[model samples]
Target: MERIELVKSIEANAERILEDFTEILQYLRSEGSDRCDEVQNLLFATRRMVDLIDSALEIYHYLIRLKYLTADTQRSETAESRDRDKMLEEMFRELNSNLGV
Candidate 1:
C-alpha cells in the first residue's frame, strides 16, 4: 500500500482502539473495586496501547510535514532551499528522538 494509505489506516485503527479503551474504562468505573486487580492490569495495558498509538500518530504527522517541506524546498531559491534543508534535518532529528533511535 501507499504511505498515505498506510497512515490513514493506522489513524483509523488508533481511533477504534481509543474508543474501545473509553468503553472499557467506563465499564470498569461502574464495576467499582470488585475487580481491582483485573482493572489495574487492563489500565496498564490500555496505557501501553495509547502510548503506541500516540507514537504512530506522531510519526504520521512527521511524514506529512516532511512531504510538505520537501515540496516547499523544491520550489524555493538556493538560500531558501538551504534553510528548508536545515529545517528538514531538524525535523528528522526530532523524529528520531521521538522514536528513541
Candidate 2:
C-alpha cells in the first residue's frame, strides 16, 4: 500500500489499542482478588499492547516529518531551477544583442 495509507492505518490501530486498553483497565478495577492469575495475564498482555502502540506512534511521527522534509526539498529545488533558467535566458539575450541579431 501507499505510504500515506500505511501511516493512517498505523494511527487508527493505535487509537483502537488505546481504547481496548482502557476497557481492560476498567474491567481489572471491578474484579475481585479471586482472579489473580487472570488479572496478571491480562496486565501482561496490556503492557505488550502499550509497547506496540508506542512504537507505531513513533513510526507515524517519523513518516510525517519525512513527508514534510521531502516537500520542502522539492520546493527548494524548483526555485533553484527557475533561477537557473532565468539566468540562461538573460545570457542568451546579451549574446544575441552583441551579434546584432
Candidate 3:
C-alpha cells in the first residue's frame, strides 16, 4: 500500500487499541466481577497491539529514511538520522529481550 495509507492505518490501529483500553477500564469500574481474567486478556491484547504499533513505526522510519516522505523531498539523511535508527534498534532489542521473543 501507499505510505500515506499505511501511516493512516497505523494511526487508526493505535487509536483502536487505546479505545479498547478505555473500554476495559470502564468495565472494571462499573462491572467488576469474575471478568478479571477477561480484563487480563485484554491487557495482553493491548500489549500486543503496542508491539505492532512499534513495528509499524519502525517501518515508517525506514520509509522516511528511504526518502519517501514526500515526492519532492530529495534530501539525504544526516548522522543524527543514523543515530536515531540505532536508538530504535536498541529499543527493539531491549523489548525483545524482555519478552524472550
Candidate achieving the largest TM-score: 2
- Cα lDDT listed for each candidate: 0.70, 0.74, 0.65
Estimated TM-score per prediction?
Answer: 0.40, 0.61, 0.35
Across residues 1-101, which tens digit of lDDT does each residue of candidate 1 receive? 45566567667756766776676566455644557866776776677567667756766775776677666666777778789999999999999999999
49-71 per-residue lDDT for model 2 (tens digits): 67667767766775777688678
Looking at model 1, how many pairs of residues clash? 0
Rank all candidate structures by their TM-score, best first, as comma-separated numbers.
Answer: 2, 1, 3
Q: On a 0 to 100 scale, what is the lDDT of residue 49 in model 1?
A: 64
Candidate 3 Cα lDDT to native = 0.65
Question: Where in model 2 is the C-alpha error above 4 Å?
Answer: 1-34
| 1 against 2, candidate with superior lDDT | 2
Clashing pairs in 1: none
For model 3, state the Cα shift of residue 11 in Å. 19
The RMSD of every model to the true structure, in order and in angstroms, is 17.3, 4.3, 20.9
